[model samples]
Target: MRPKIENITDLRGEISRLRVQRLEQEVELTKVTARLKARLHFPVLVYTKISDFFIELFGDDPEDLNKKKENKDWVTNILRVGLPLALNRFLFPRSGFLMKSVVAMVSQKAAKNVNKDSITGIIDKVTDWIKSSKEKSRKEPRMADYGIPPDSETY
Candidate 1:
């Protein structure tokens, strides 16, 4: 390894250099340890792992999500992601964290039932109802003078 120590002065120099090298290595070790400690910090790490577990548990497969994107099955994804969020924000706005979490879990499960076809059917029905309402509100033909008296701006 190191060249053979010759004189006393050289030995002293080598010892000083070795000590400096050891201190440098120790400093590097502390830096690495700090980085590891930050990464392993309890609350953040646990929260991340728990959230990941819940996501996987709740039928969120990475490949499936990608496939859904390719298929443009946005309705299912939106329902899954948004329904729980909407419920938590609106239905349980003032509820405690536990109740909100329960609502979110339940709504996430229920959202599975609302696929594109179901949402599209509901949308079609709503549009049809709106169209029918508009048709029903159409002005009616009647006796001309009586209708003018009712609709016209006059004394």
Candidate 2:
């Protein structure tokens, strides 16, 4: 004959453990849902579209530009340096409401630092810096001095 159990303690302990596991799973699920929602948000889509537009507008065909040679032109310069700086300025400001919404949804701390005035100031500074850098480069000797073919002849 087998001995019978008297107390319900074992069953109660198992129930509590299962409840804890379920709560953890729910918390994890909520986090994943929030991240997915943020990723699919409309502002992100708009931002991506704007970036694509700028790239298409300013960039040349990659196949035409030889990477081994230091080739610089106004269009290439604008596409490489100006576009990214402009996009960063455009996307992280309080004026960038959609971007702020996405950032806030993802991480509260990051959203705190994203505001309009500061981003505008930074944009101005970067613009000035790019202008100065371009001017400085123009003052330097030609690629012929460094043994690279002139950019025009290559293309």
Candidate 3:
């Protein structure tokens, strides 16, 4: 009987030890799964530096309005725009320079067209209209004119 009881106690201890190990394995698996899920959801970001050598050679001086005006010619445009685009595509086939250049040009044109004074005038008009509407509402008693008591409440 004593030997049988000792064997049963040893089995129970082994079962408890196995349970602890299983729990530890489950925790590790969860951490690994979370890492894998994160990797799948968010790809790694890669940034490539564009060499300034070509820009320095072919690009126009940004501060020189005269050079910018001169670049409007077809020949200059081909040199400034066409060559860089072609070279970029040849060197880096997957580079997004075309889209970036188009967006930059469009935004620069839009910025040039925006009038600060016009925007300020519109804002002033809106504020004045709001103030006038509030004043008119306070000055006129619509409910009283309609024969409703000022203090009465209805829903």
The CA lDDT of each predicted structure is: 0.83, 0.63, 0.62
- Which scores better on TM-score, 2 or 3? 3
lDDT per residue for candidate 3 within 1-155, as digits (tens), equals: 12233677788887887799899999999999999978866443221123244346666465664655653544444445555456556755665867657644554444443344555788999999999998887854444377776779987
Ordered from best to worst TM-score, the candidate numbers read 1, 3, 2
Off by over 4 Å in 3: 1-95, 140-155
lDDT of 2 by residue, 8-46 (tens): 986677678779989999999999999998988988899
User: Which structure among the candidates has the greatest TM-score?
Assistant: 1
Residue-pair clashes per candidate, as listed?
0, 0, 0
Q: Using Cα atoms with residue i matched to residue i, what is each candidate's TM-score against the true structure?
A: 0.43, 0.27, 0.27
Candidate 1, overall lDDT?
Answer: 0.83
Top of the candidates by lDDT: 1
Per-residue lDDT of 95 in model 3:
56
